[model samples]
Target: MPLAQRVHNLPSYLFAGLEAKATELKQRGVDLIDLGIADPDLPPVDIVKQSLIRHLDDPDAHQYPSSVGDLAVRKAVAGWMQARFGVAIDPAMEICITSGSKEGLANLSRAYAEPGTVVAATDPGYPVYANAGAILNGAGFRALPLTPDNQFMPDLTLAEGARLLYLNYPNNPTGAVADESFYREVAAFADAHPETLVIMDAAYCELSFLPPKPPSLLQFSKNVIEFHSLSKMMNVTGYRIGFAAGQPEAIAALVKIKTQLDSGAPVFIQRAMAEALAAYDGVNPPADAQESHNEYGRRKALLEKGLKDVPGVKQVYPSPATFFVWASVDDDVAFVEHAMEKGVILTPGRGFGEAGEGFIRAAVTTSADRIELALQRLRDE
Candidate 1:
């Protein structure tokens, strides 16, 4: 069997080792609370489900979909951006839907990373961003470290030769949210560095716990590119519906790159997505879903409480949005194993980046019961 040489040097996911250990425990009949991934347990909206079924029968749906998503879905996305973020998006020129935000980020790297380029992303950030850089021998781009002390936002001064700056607010793992002041600073940073491109990973924007909405890059800088996903907010991860909006140049570059990689999403999926957004007005989230957030909040409180006693864990900050709790921990490998052996599965900080080595990302994707259960196990261990 042969594989691409470029992929041979890539490292296995940092969280995989712990997850494998968790799998081993589960094989032995241990109900290991799997909290490593931020995959939501809820189902997508009913309209989305029905739409998929109805479209499944269409012969056109069987063929390859267009490279650019259908007009309806694009319009829906533009509508969402305008209604939610107060930014007007030209569905055709300003927005392009991707299979998922992860793919959007990966290909986005290819679009921006010319030779001798640097890409800035938060430390303890999502792994795909770093992997994107490694693929092209640093030609893809490098991530700048964003630490807990800085409230998980990168200091513009620390970023050097950064052609692309990738950011996620209501961030993954850390669950941090940025205010208008933070965004204003980012805009100012981009203004000072006109040559640089700011890629905003707003995947979790819709899942925010804050009011007045999360600050958007579009609000501040014309050079900024933004990515949004239906995965977390709508519990439609498997559906692979995500989109990006930004300057026409950046958006056009990404769309061109994406076209070469694969065909676009099915028309029915686009229709369904549009329907989901329309139905969003009257949609009532299930109790379990509502409870999911509350439960995570409770677990966050409990974890923070427990952290006070844990030696080597420091710089604990309260998470205001998203479904993750980031904590600085020494010996992530050992800690993850110990917790998993006691029936808990946590993502090691190193999985995100080298800067994440001293930390762990605790996802609230699981139920509060599981969170409580995992915390108890950690406390006992």
Candidate 2:
């Protein structure tokens, strides 16, 4: 009756602790303005909802789906990729539907990672990158700290021996966006190594505020595998549908691993995701994107302005893409507790990685009014 060491050795999932703290505050009658997790407040687009409704009655929707995915869904994903990033991929050979980008990431580890295999990830990054190593029973996890001096891009030189290098642009927590030149550097580095596989987590690609949205790493090199999620872009987090596209062999390997893991994403959800992707022109921003941008813009402006005058807040990190504001502080844990006591919930940066210590991450997913209230609470504290 002993648990596996892999399960026992894993660090506590970051957000679970945040949720528990929020619950404790609620029980104590504190009306909390949560700015922790990046869960969008919006619902899925009309077309996506309609597609789900139309497909729910189809008999095939109830059965287990292929591990690779539905054909139409893969085709739609290809078209979307072409339209969005001008990168063409063979749907049959390069695409694999996943329950979410996280599922695809974990499965990539299962397929390729092993003990002593080095996996390089940006510190203050999404926990999934590091957790992938833990799942492999102690794969070497290298922390490539993203510092201000480096413009928040990890130095590829530090990832020398890494077999898997994970990069997330329009980064979570930090909200830093990688440009084409940055991708060119990555491509060169990958070319130099030749054996390393680059995993680009583009979950926040569509959330860019600037024109001519973020470019795909595939535009620079085929040596990289990219993950895309509808959760952030289309506000369909509950659907748990996304895709991984890259080298055919890597896609095949992921397919082999997933075949033993679980069946594919739900058919109705995949159908809805396909319809949504098909309708995307990649020229005009979707209504959901426009709405989210405007709202996050307003909240970000308010939060930045307010933080400038707050005590203990050292710097408000620039966020041109994701729905988060990474701020440098004297002590992350202390600031989180102080903010919580004043009825505002902010995520401590240390929860992301050790390099995140002395910082805090506040999500702009809440309403402008609530963000204003949270700022007032911080000022009062």
- Top-TM-score candidate index: 2
Off by over 4 Å in 1: 1-5, 57-60, 137-141, 282-315
| lDDT for predicted candidate 2 compared with the true structure | 0.85
What does the lDDT read for residue 110 in candidate 2?
Answer: 76
Candidate 1 has a TM-score of 0.90
**Candidate 1 lDDT over residue span 1-381, tens digit each:** 898765775777655666667777888899888777788875665667877788778676667776667777889888777666678888888888888888888887787675567767787787776667435534554556767667777777766567777788878767788889888888888778877887789987766553655767887776678988877766778998888887888888887987999798767777767766655442233343445455556666766666555555665667667877778777887777777777878878888877778787777777667777777777774
After aligning candidate 1 to the native by TM-score, how far in Å is the CA of 177 from where it should be? Answer: 1.0
lDDT: which candidate is best? Answer: 2
Q: Candidate 2: which pairs clash?
A: none
Give one digit per residue, the lDDT tens place, for model 2 in 1-381. Answer: 998788777788765866788899899888999888688876667778889999999898999999999988999999988987889999999999999899998898777778878888999899888876545547878999987778789988988888888889989878898878999999888778877888899998888877658898888988788999988887778889999998788899999999999899999999988888887767545676577666776777777778776778999887778888888999898888888888888999989899899989988878888888888878874
Give per-model TM-scores. Answer: 0.90, 0.96
**RMSD of each candidate?**
2.8, 1.5
